[model samples]
Target: MNTLNYLHLDEKRVADVVTALHLLLADFQIHYTNLRGFHWDIKGHGFFVLHSKFEDLYNDTAEKIDEIAERILTLGSVPSNKFSDYLKVARIKEISGVTCGSEAVEHILSTYGHLIGEERKVLDLAAEAGDEVTVSLMSDYLKEQEKMVWMLTAFSSKTCGK
Candidate 1:
């Protein structure tokens, strides 16, 4: 009774996926904000590289935020739009004051780790609901993100010595 079932799907079964998507949306917003901070805060060596990288990340994060919010609407639920709501539900934490290039990249990598896991969980949920749209969305995001993780790791090797 709580769902609109516009897609002629079992709204009950997909509700869990909807809930998970809401959490993903919240986490993405926080992640986006953190990247914005990193873009502005990074300094020292590799500043040119990292600053632009952070900007690119935040721009992509903004697109993800829209995708997730729209997915929630597609699932017949409202996406949380407030920062207060985001902080309450997001597993990704807010980070700041990290101006070091290595540290900032490390933070972004760590954040991506958390996001990738969550996206997998969402993928499972969507598959269970027979939601191919959600599945494709997550799959694409995962592919792009995994590549980003690898690239960032490689980029960090020189400075972090990892």
Candidate 2:
């Protein structure tokens, strides 16, 4: 239909996927800020390891943010760009001034779990809409993030809540 992209997906379903992607974009915006804060603020015994690790994580988060926004554009919608908007819609909240490595890692774990959940939601909608590009994007994200969740949980010295 006229509402569909060149990909010829169901317009209504694609709209649902686009909405989900916008929420995911908001989550990543807050997530990126949190990662940056943890990278800059982390102190104590795990500083050397966690500081570098958080830096890596934030870099990855930045890429994800760009990818998500571009994906939203491809889906014929605008990504949410305002931090105030991000704060309002993001399930992952912005945290700051956290100097403890384990505490920050704990937050990271929680955030990753939430992100995976949201990605799955998007993935499902995309699949329903036959938007394989978005589906693949979410699938790759889910795989890597699930691995990060495992590793972060170990670094936090916690059992897998699963």
Best by TM-score: 1
Cα-based lDDT for every prediction: 0.90, 0.87
Worst 10 residues of 2 by lDDT: 1-10
Best of the candidates, lDDT: 1
lDDT of 2 by residue, 1-162 (tens): 243556687777788998988899998989899999999888889799999999999899899899999988877777877889888888887799999988898898888889898999999988888899999999999989999888887777756676
Query: Each prediction's Cα RMSD?
Result: 2.4, 3.2
Q: Compute the lDDT of residue 67 as modeled in candidate 1.
A: 94
Q: What are the clashing pairs of model 2?
A: none
Candidate 1 ranges with C-alpha deviation above 4 Å = 1-4, 159-162
List model 1 lDDT by residue over 1-162, tens digit each: 534555766888898999999999988998999999999998899999889889999999999999999989878888877899999988999998889988988888999999999999999999998999999999999999999999999887755633
Error of 1 at 81 (Å): 1.0
